[model samples]
Target chain A: MMVTGKKHEAAAAPSGAKLDLSHVSKVFRGGQGVHDISLSLEPEMIHGLIGANGSGKSTLLSLIAGQRFADSGLITYGGDHVNEHAAALSQICLVKTYERSWENYSLKEIFKFASIFYPHWDEQLASELMDKFQLKGSKNYQQLSRGGQSMTGIIKGLASRAPLTLLDEPVIGLDASMREIFYRTLLEDYSNNPRTFVVTTHLIEEAENLFERMVYIKRGRVAFQGPVEDFAANAVYASGPATVLEKLLGDVRVLHSERLGGKLLLALEDLSGPAERRMLQDQGVELSPVPLQKLFVYLTLRDAENSQGGGNR
Target chain B: MSYRSLMKFHLKDYRRGALILLSIFVCVDTALVLLMKFLPAWDMGTADNIFSINRNIMSIFMIISMIVTVAITFPLMSSFSVTRRNFYVSSLLALLAFCITAALAETAVYLIGRAVLPSIGLPVDVDRPILLSAYVFMLTLLDVSVATFLIGACYYRFKVITGTLLAIVYFGAVSLISQMFPSMEYMENFALFSSDPAMLEPGTTLLAWGIIALCAGAGWLIYRRTDIRM
Candidate 1:
């Protein structure tokens, strides 16, 4: 359903390393943090992670980055446990927003160091992209401004070309123009040498189009996940005769509903498609697709209402 | 990356602090030498030539040591807690600097001792290889060990601090409680050494190495358990 996706084509995953994050339950000593989450990530796609602060987004990234160890569950890269097996994690790269604090080296120096660790580092591409990002390679890390520092990290993440790339808000300080450039560069890079990318961001609406899949994390758990088309296809605008919309709610879960001067507007789950649309049309109903943001809000609120226990996060 | 390349990357980061430290050391050393020459000599009965290191000199060293420790650990006092990878990187740099400082301090003391000993009319043992080597080695070992323990204790207490009071209090309390108490001596009483001062004290050297290893291990363990971004 997206702009460029094939209609009759099989779902061919992007080519690069596959991530198997299975049964990942992490809890703080006093019984806090995320728990019992499980998901597998395939390559050649941009995965969006959406959540409010302290919702275990950063913790999940940290666990993947080798920054923090999980109390339980295993994160497998290329089918091997990353924490226990060194070989497994070599290809997966997680670049956190504050990762530079762990390193004091200059952008160029760190990149040089990373090249040896990440065998597939593309130096020429890094230099070219650095120019585009307007970063100073020779500058010391302490000297760069926040946005510039973020640019440095983004450059490293893109340049590494590691099989699995996790960017946790790498564009925090970027201007809108720079962010657009980043998205373009990301798309160009991915198109050329497709790798699995997981982008965690607050600016979901702007980048929703790029996400092959979106992981809307609510209260430290996967609230919803799957291909954008599949998830988007589930979105339905079931505006109809008030009685028909109300009665139609029995089998379909309506994510959102509104009464527009007695005419009803209801967003329902994706039931069996055309026949239901036809049935609704026959009953003087209306239907349409939901924007990514509306879907996020509706699903988030629904998940919150359902749980009543995710703690206000 | 290869180990040497990794080290170079970490070591290159000391550009700012090292330059700042080198300049401060140069200026302070110049000013101190001038001040010493400008002042009248303190009286030392029966030791006219000896440049006796007393309360003043010791206090200067104490201040300088604290300053160096503060400067060295500045980068670590952040929301980002150290990781095992970062621990190795920073420790390697710290170790190298510690060695270089020990060498310079020992050399300066030797020269000052040579000049001051003759002035005090004491027979200077310029060729006393055993004494010189033992004293140099002991002083170097003492400097590195003391510094390591000081940082370890400070890092353990607050993980990071800016106020001088916390650094001084934690460092003083830990060093005094651990070393001054007869039953709680550093390294020497861990049953890790059999050195007796009058009997060559060779086991003391072994104890020093053991203590260094223990501190390194402790540092790594602390880093492993701390929050990723504390």
Candidate 2:
């Protein structure tokens, strides 16, 4: 149905998005989900929502989708509170990991059903996806394999082409080839449409290059967020003997360390000068670039370690 | 969310589930009918008055359908997005469909019985007007009431198996307590149709439906706030 005082196409096929999630803490009665979190996402970019299990990544996503409400704050999308954006849920395609079966309905039926709310829903894309995915109309949903079922869900979210697309672990079950297909299709689609795609996953390394910005969620809060390259560049790894490395790096930040025989692999932060490099070299230290994955690991883990260590650093 | 659209889409799902369920219903009902016709040893202690016997047979089929519909609805409820704003509204619609479907299925049996029975004034005990409207309302009541706890419990708690078991255990336990307390006997009033399927008085019918609507609204509010972790 056409919403009041809004253009039909503009409402559905929104070019840019403004997503604001304020002090949104989801506290279960039993103390389980998200806690005191706040985030504002920029539009027309691939924003990665990453966190370890129980860090409230999924809870935050649910709040954005209005599948679950925040106990204490607001989730505003396109200048409207999420609940008020009931009209927008149709335009926001949420691909949940555990959602199984649209209940034996044909692939066509599934698209048709969802298409009611999404005025900008690409029917051609839906048909193309079914062909690309090779999903048969006659087969029951339960008859498909685990990967196949996931593919169907992925198709729904992608084909819906919602302006604010949230994909929560969409490629977990698929093989490398299928994941590549997903990534390529996602990039291609985003380029063509220029819509906001918020993807939450543990597989950061695979798509690190694709990310424009990253939201590293640690304990339901943004521990670190910036451009993916900048995020990876924030921490660098250097190596040498444990004592020499410690002395050379004295008060500087070190996210992780391991002594291989007599050599220490030290994940370093705040590189300064040639003198510092020489000092580390004289100590037989070797510096290496920390991959985005390692940077993520260090950022997430080091924060927890510091939170526990009483800020002695 | 567009409830009408969601409902239409859901009914598509319901068709598959319904077909499987109806196949089970038809096969069982058809088998029972065939058994009554051909199988002498399988007969219940049914009286020989053809009209009365046919009505009783139809009653047996209606009760079976009611049980099956209730049993599977729990699973469908569990699979749905129970923590959303759509939960209660969807539940009400599902219940409405369930009740209407059951009543219609039951009505079919009544018609069949009327056709098969010996010469009697209109064959079946159902009043056309009463069966038509009252079934819609009664189905609404049964569905919304049962859905209140079912939808709430399923969304808040994980595991469909555990959720269903818990709902049954809780219902049975609460029902027993209500039996013991005089003031709590009102809990049983919703099930008045089950006790006497001979339609309802207008006041009680309105009261039952009003309670269902109130419960449904309350359930919707609860669902919105409830944390959907899964």
Candidate 3:
């Protein structure tokens, strides 16, 4: 079956800045970091940075935000080097899950300093979000619950109104209803104020609909980068008899395969075209769409298998 | 503009803590001075020594405050897209302001005590020249502040374990050198300002400034390259 969903429209004329990373790399002493990542992110679009834990997602965001200097290569925003250009750095905001330095500060104090530093900080919006999240400005950050702490970071990211805002696991501790409110507020804000947003989250399915572009990182490399719809369309599951499926999927990269009773369910990547998919369907193979979360799991599992010399299982 | 704003923010953040520290010193010293006045038999020295005692306490306070300020504000400012240069410069300015404030407060307390205690029939002698003492106290506090700021920067850059070890090694080296040259007294002259205004040495003051410059430069190099780990 075809992966049918509401394809996100092309972003409106960009009020935000463009970001480009060319051959960027950062390696830690323990040998884990991003490597040779070259990517171009257009303005005024929501980009999802998806990856497994320790896949350099946070490192990549840090490099982009100038929080961590890249070991090599260049990262530019609005045609200026992010780290070298003070103006460019000022236009970007990156919010992490937890900031140890913030523990002693109250939310009111945080906002006070943020307003001084972020030239375009939206005080009214910050206040409104605080109310919506049911957080007290007088409470120190360390006194908040885990979810409340996440809300504080989220409020900062949203209220900064920077041209490029990067949120790393913004909804980590948010409950279901709070998460829904966050999604709603984010989309509403984007509609009103179009800018570049790069959100890294583990909840792929929940955020899938919000992302216009998806960048998948695997083992410190860019495994895939394209529109979310294209990412979903490129890989799929084809379940049928083992022998028939094998004959049909010749030479194609199988991301995952499992034997269920007498049948085989294979997750295949880069399926050629409609003609190939139809042919598989004609061969008594039931082709179905793969969910974004499932596709991520399958891809990571496939990489793990390949690394262990278990080829195309 | 951002630099000025950051400087202002830091001053605001630190002022309350500075006031609280100053208050604690004033309260404790006031109580001590009162006890000494009422029970002259318990008095160990001239009451005018409060000025020097307060200067010593302020020096220790300056070091602790600088370290805490850097540890707290570096990450906070970095998160706000503050450049390392701006953060460092603004922090230094704030620390200088704090040292100056502390010096003025100490001088005011001493002048007040010298004037009031003698009028109240408590014998108090002027042990040190007031203006010279204030100048010495300010310079001494500044030197300690800069040195402590460098250590704080090192702590953030190298992380907790290595930073703590480095601090221990540094103090150990200083102590060993002081023990080896007990007669020379060079370490004491290098580390502290003379409480007696007549004994104030220009060479010692210049050495303090040189050490401040060295620490500021080295700290900036480390801080500029340091990653803002969340």
Candidate number of the best lDDT: 3
Q: List native contact recovery per candidate, as a fraction of 1.
A: 0.09, 0.25, 0.64
Every model's TM-score: 0.73, 0.76, 0.89
Query: Candidate 3: which stretches are off by over 4 Å?
Result: A1-15, A246-252, A258-260, A273-275, A306-313, B119-121, B159-196, B201-204
- lDDT by residue (B153-218, candidate 2, tens digit) is 443445467557655764675478446643333344332223233343344345445545655665
Error of 3 at A159 (Å): 0.8
Please write out the lDDT profile of model 1 over residues B80-172, one tens digit for every residue.
222344445454455555545544554465466556655745445423233433343443344444445446444544466623444475457
- Candidate 2 vs candidate 3: which has greater TM-score? 3
Candidate 3 colliding pairs? A1-A287
lDDT of 3 by residue, A1-313 (tens): 1111221121222356789999999999877899999999989999999988888999999899888999999999999988836788888888998989899889999989887887667777788899999999999999999999999999999888787999999999899999999999999888777888999999999999999999999878898899999887877788998888876445547777889987999888767588988987888899888888998888777777666795633
lDDT of 2 by residue, A180-279 (tens): 8888888887777788888888788998767899987776677777787776664668876777875644454777777788777878765656688777
Candidate number that wins on TM-score, 1 or 2 = 2
Best by TM-score: 3
Which ten-residue region of model 2 chain A has the weakest summed lDDT? A1-10
All candidates: DockQ = 0.18, 0.25, 0.64
Determine the C-alpha RMSD for candidate 3 after optimal superposition of all C-alphas: 5.9
